[model samples]
Target: MKKYLGPILFFAVFEAVAVTLWLTMDHLFYLFNFTYIGGSVALGLVLYIRKWKYARLMVQLAVGLYMLIYLGILSRENMQIEGFWYYLFLGVFEAATIHYVVAKIAGPLLFGRGWCGYACWTAMILDLLPYKTPCGPRRKLGYIRYITFGISLLFVGGLFLLHVPDLEKVMFWSFFIGNALYYGVGIALACAFKDNRAFCKYICPITVFLKPASYFSLSRVKNDTEKCVSCGKCKTVCPMDVDMTDNARRRKNGTECILCLKCVEACPKHSLHI
Candidate 1:
């Protein structure tokens, strides 16, 4: 019962904020966007400090589902903005700037990729996905984010350098189908790969963008090697399949980390610190 208190309190706070935003704002869908990222971060902070698993999971589901509905299925107005060249430039610039600032402040100063664990909308959805993925003994899969990052960069750059006047027409038609496919494929992959956050770990372009930015984030997951019993709970609970123990042991920071704080909460011996 004590374990459930923190989550319940956090959920109440999150819902209150959402209702306030909805009542006050003209564009309620925008609130959905803000809630997914902003609310997740706030909840993650509470969970990190309080070590509440249920609260973390609750925030994960609420924020993740809202994002899917808003960004993926409900409307294409947001994606429509991408059709304009200036809007596209500004959007990518703003996104990159936010990613860089948040990552730098969170990664080095406070916790490594802690932002990814809590703040990323993509990670939020991946967290709610119920399945387990195979954790291979090797660390080769960690490089997938780097490849994704490169591809996103190329896509953004191609849009800027190549003057494609018909891009918007193409995008307008593609948006609905593309988003549906994306969500469908992501959910299917989650069902297939039970252990890891299949979509977040291997496919999300947003994660690719956030990885470099997270390097500069203020917070990070820290480990107390001495207290660690090597139970591997942190790794088991990790949606991204990151070996928190290995990461803690090496003190090596990577862009793949979402900073959801699951590893911190999962450490039975309190070996994982954030």
Candidate 2:
């Protein structure tokens, strides 16, 4: 029962969001969207608890492909950061706006960067690259994320400032091209850095929102010292370079944790848990 609590809580949270949005916005899509995502995540959690190796990747694809293909392409809703800005400026409280509020922005306060680990379409493809672990020390280039974030804001702002005609079409095209650019750069950086998460660590504009809210995340990996032998396997396997051994909020790369559970899997002493 205790072990199942994590999945139950996550499903409940997402369901609450689903019901609220469905009732308030008068859209059944919200109910369907969040329910599917929540169920996928809950299933993944159950698989992880059962020691399934590809549990995280399974969730990543189930959610990521659904968003990228069904919502973004078929339904023509831009779920990207640029789309969030586009919808926000139009004072439209649907689609990307609601998505950002629930997933990337305020949602991080509860789940940390779990979205990055289990549901980013960009990262879903990037994670398939050969470099599962970083080859060298983390670089000082994380400042690049801020630059990218600013660029996204300015790009959308420029379109509105210029009063571009046929704005919806342009936004849809931007969503298409922007995802292409992300995949191109993300793959190149991953191969260059020998790190699967290089783009996530240094270039993802969403991190600007995810990091601050995630700093106070209620769900986090913790190390139990009483059960511990100081084997450094956890650190070696952590994709985000988090020091999960330290339970403090200010631990090294603490906000960067995506809750991927590689650290937990690698802990021979079984001292790590959420």
The residue-by-residue lDDT of candidate 2 on 115-221, one tens digit each, is 99999999999999999999999999999999999999999999999999998899899989999999999999999999999999999999999999999998899
Cα lDDT tens digits, model 1, 174-273, are 5455456556767786666553466666665555545554555444566788998888778766656556676443333345566666677678898876
TM-scores for candidates 1 onward, in order: 0.60, 0.98
Ten contiguous residues minimizing lDDT sum, candidate 2: 225-234
The Cα local distance difference test for each model comes to: 0.53, 0.94
Best candidate according to TM-score: 2
lDDT of 1 at 272: 79
State, as a TM-score between 0 and 1, how close model 2 is to the true structure.
0.98
